[model samples]
Target: MHYTFSQYYIYVIFVAVMAAFSYLNKLNRTEVFSFFMYAIMLLFAVLRIDTGADYSTYIEMHEEAGKSYFTDLFSFTEPLYFLLLKVLYFFSDDYWLMFAVVAIIIYTILFLAVKKLSIDPALSLLLYIIVAYYFISINQLRQSISLVIFLYSISSIIDKKPGKYYLLNIIGFGFHYSAVMAFLIYPIVNTSFSKKTLTIIFILSIVLSPVIEKLFVTYLGELDTLYTKYFDIEEYMEKNYLALGKVIVPNLILIYSLIKFKSFTRYEYSIFMIYFCSIVYYNIFFGKHIFIRPGMYFEIVTILYIPIFIKKFFDLVTGFIIETLIILYYAFSVTLYGILINGGQGVVPYKLIFSR
Candidate 1:
C-alpha cells in the first residue's frame, strides 16, 4: 500500500511548480493565474484520483434506478445532491464530469460571496484554490456539492436575507442532511461576542463535549438507523476521532486570535467562534463524524475570514520578510499535509481517474 517513488516524485514536482507560479504571480496579482489555478484544480477534481467509496455507491445507485425510478430518492440523506448527481450521471458515467460541475458551482458561488464581502479578488481566488485543492477531493459528489450550496446560502445570509438563506440550506439538505444543522446556526450569525461571552462559549464547548455525545448516540441513534446501510457508527467515529486534533488545534488558534485582535465584525466573529467551538466540542466527544462531517461546511465560512485576518495581521506586524515567510510556511505546510500525507484527500488525482 505504499505509493511508488514515481508517484511521490510526480506529486512533488507538480506542487513545486504550482508553488513557484503562485509566488511569482503574487507580485503582479494577475487574473490569468487565478483562472489557470481554477482550471487546474477543476481538472484535478475530474481525474477522480483518490476518490472515496461514496462515489462508487452513488454510481451504483444511479445505474440501478434506471429512468423509471429515482435511484437515490429514498436512500439518500441529501436529496439536492442526489438529484444533481442523477442529472449529471445522465450525460456520462465519467465521475470527472460530476467533479467538474461541482467545482464550477463552488467557484462561482465563492466568487460572488467574496466579491460581495469586498474582499480582494486575488486573495479570494487564492483561498478558493486552497479549499478546492485541499478539501473537496475525497467526497467529490456529496461533500463538495453540499459545500457549494452551503456557501451560496451563507452569502445570502450576508445580504441579510434570511428567507433566501434558509431556502438554500433546505435545498442543500436535500443533497446532505448535515446541511440542515447549518440552518440552526443562522440566528446567531451576526450575534455579538464579548470577553465574557467568548469565555462562556469556550467553557461550554469543553463541558458539553461528553454530554453532547451521550445525547447524540442515544437520541439521534434513530437518525443513524435510518441511514444505517450507508453509515457505520464505529468506522465513522474512528475516522472522525482520529482527525479531530488536526481541526481543533488550528481552530483554537484562530479563535484566540479573533478574540485578542477583535478585528472581525460581530457577526463574522460570532459565526466563526461558534462554529469553531461546535467542531471542537463535537470532535472531543462524539468523534469525527460530528466534526469532519460538518467541518467541511464550516471551512467555507472560516476560510472567508482567514485571508482578511492574514492581511490584517500583516498590516499590524509591519515586516515584509516575516509575512513572506508566513505565507510560504502556510503554502508548504498546508500543501504537504493536505496533499502528500493525505493522498491529496481534497485534491482530485487527475492521473488516477482512468486507473480507478
Candidate 2:
C-alpha cells in the first residue's frame, strides 16, 4: 500500500506544525521541545522519498557486495554511517525503519553539538531542518548519512582538538570521500591570519576562478571521469547549476553580513572568508557546481555565525527576529526543493536494503 502525495503532504504539515509549536513555546522545557523535533524528523525519515539514479547505485552496491563487504567498502571513511547501516541490516530488511533511526540519531547529535557550542536551541533546530529537509531529506541513504559524519567532524574541529577532528574527518571520508576536503583545510584554518595573508588569499581566489575549469579539464580530467563513472557527477553538476543564482545570492548576503558585523573570532573569520572566497570563485567560473551544492554542507556553520553576528550588531529582539526569518526562509526553500522540484514521493528505495 503506497502512500499518495496527499498523504505525504498531510504528514509533512503535521510534523512542521508540531515543530513550530514547540519552537514558539520558549518558556517550555528545552528537552521536551528537542525531543519533539527529533520525533517529527524520525517520522519524516520513516516516510522518506528518494528519486533519481543515486538510489539505484546504492542498491546495486548492496546486492553486489552482500552485507559484510557492503560495510567494508562503503565504510572507507564514514565508519559511523557504515556501521549504523550494517547494524540495521542485521536486524531487519526494512530500509525505511533504518533510515528513520539514522535520521533520529543524526538530528540528536547535531542538536547536542550546537548546544554544547553555546548556540541557541531555536537556531540549532533551524539548522537541522535546513539540512535534513532541504539538502538531505530527498537522498537519505548516502548524502544524509554523510552529512551526519560531517557534523561530527565539525564538532570535533570546534572543540579545538585536532586529533579528534582528524579522526572524525577520517570517519567522514569513509562514508563519503568528498569529506576529505575538510582535512586539507586544517593548515589554512589553524594558521594566524595577517592583513597581507587575507589579501593574498582573496587575490588567489579571484584569480583562480577562470582557470579552475581548465585546470580540472586538463589535469584532473581523469579524476572527473572516475567520479562520473562512480557517482554520475555530470548529472548532478547539471542540475546543481540550474539554481546557481539563488544559491550564490544567499552566500553573497552571508559574506556581506560577516564583513559588516566584524565581530568574528579569528577562526570564525577564517572560515567565513575562505568559504566566501570559494563561493565567489565557484560562482564565477564553474557556475553552481563548485560552491552551491557542496556549500549546502556549510549552512549549519552559516546559521551559527548569523546569530552571533546578529547579537553583535542589533538588540536581542531584533536579532531573534532576523534569525527566525532566515530559518523560515531556508526551511521553505528546502521544502520546496524536496517536495516540488525533486518530485519526492515518500518512498524509500527498498532495493538498497539487502540482496533480494
Candidate 3:
C-alpha cells in the first residue's frame, strides 16, 4: 500500500519532461506546455493518500464534519473550509473525493497565477516544486488555498487598488485565518524606502532578532488564544538556530535585490517590497514555527520574484545558466529535505486512495 521515497522521483522525472516540453515549445506553444505541467502536478496531488503531515488529520476532520452539526464544525475549522467540506459531504461521504476536489481548486489557482503573473511561467512551475510549495500544499490545504488567493491579489497591490486587495484577503481569511496576515501586503508594497534606509532596516532586523524573540515570548505568550497556543517559547528558543536555514537564502536574495533597488520597475519594486516584508517577518519571529506562517503570505512570491531577480541581476545568457543551476539545486535539496529532514511531511511511503 505504501511506496518508498524513491516514488518521489516520479515527480522529478515528470518535471524533467515538462521542462523539456516547455523548452522545446516555449515560443509557439508555451500555454499548452504549462497546462501539461500543471496537469501532472494536479494528478500527483489529487491521487495522493495518507500523504502529508495533515493527511490523516484531514481525513479525520472530514469524517467528523460529516457527523457533526454545521455550527459545531465551524468551531473546529474556518467557516469557508468547513462549509465546503459540508457541501462535499452532502454529495458523497468519501474523503478522497473531497480531497481531490480541494486539490483541483488549489492547483487550478496556482497554475493560473503563475501563468498570468510570472515572467517565466515554466521556471515558476519548477520553483513551485523545488521550493517545497508542492509539499506544503499537500500538507496545509487550507492555508495553501488561502495563499494562492493572496497570490492573485498581488495584482491589486501593483495596481494600487487597496479595496480589491483587502477584499480578496478577507475572502481568503474565510478559509484560513493566516490570510489575515495578507492585509499587510498593500501597505508594504505602497510604502517607499530609499536604498540606504532599506539596507539599514534589513540589518536592524537581523541584529535585533533576538530581542524580538524575547519580546514576543514575554508579551504575546501571555495571551490565551488560538494563535498563541502554538508558542512553545522554551523549545523554539533552543531551536533558534534552525530558523537560519529557512531565511538564509531569502536574506541573500534580498541583499542582492536591494543593491539594484533603484533600477526596479514599478511592478518589480512592489514584489521586492513584498519579498522584503517576508524576510522582516521571519526575522521578527526568528525561531518560532507558528509565527513564521504569516510570512508565507509574502514568501510565496519567491516563485515569481526569483525569475524577476535573475533577469535583473544578470544578462540573458548568464541568467539562463543561473536559473538552471537554481533549478538543479532546488530539485536536489528540496527532495532530500523531504526524504531526510521532512520525511515527506508525512508524505513518504506515499499511497493512493485505493492503496488499502
Per-residue CA lDDT of model 2 for 1-356, tens digit only, reads 23445534643564367557546645664666655665665655455434333555554544333367553754345555566667677777655555567556666666665555534556555555553343344454555555555555665554578898788667666666566556755565566655556555555665775577566666766765554432133454444332432354355555555456455675466446545544554544453233333554544455455545556666868876766676566555544344334443233232222332
Estimate candidate 1's alpha-carbon lDDT, on a 0 to 1 scale.
0.55
The best-first sequence of candidates by lDDT reads 3, 1, 2
lDDT string, candidate 3, 30-120, tens digits = 5777787789889988888887778878888787777778777558648888888888899999898988999999989899888878887
Which 10 consecutive positions of candidate 1 have the poorest summed lDDT?
237-246
lDDT tens string, model 1, 1-356? Answer: 22444554545565555555555666776566555655665555555554553566656655543342475466756556667667877887665666667757766655555555524454554544443333443455555556667766766666678888888777767767677667766676656566676666666767776677677677775665564422343564343322433454445556656466656665466446545655554445444243456656665554456545556555645534443554454444554444444454533233566686
> TM-score for each prediction?
0.73, 0.70, 0.87
Worst 10 residues of 2 by lDDT: 345-354
Off by over 4 Å in 1: 8-25, 48-55, 65-75, 92-96, 114-135, 207-245, 263-287, 316-339, 342-356
lDDT preference between candidates 1 and 2, better one: 1
Stretches > 4 Å off in candidate 3: 1-8, 11-29, 70-76, 214-245, 338-341
TM-score of 1: 0.73
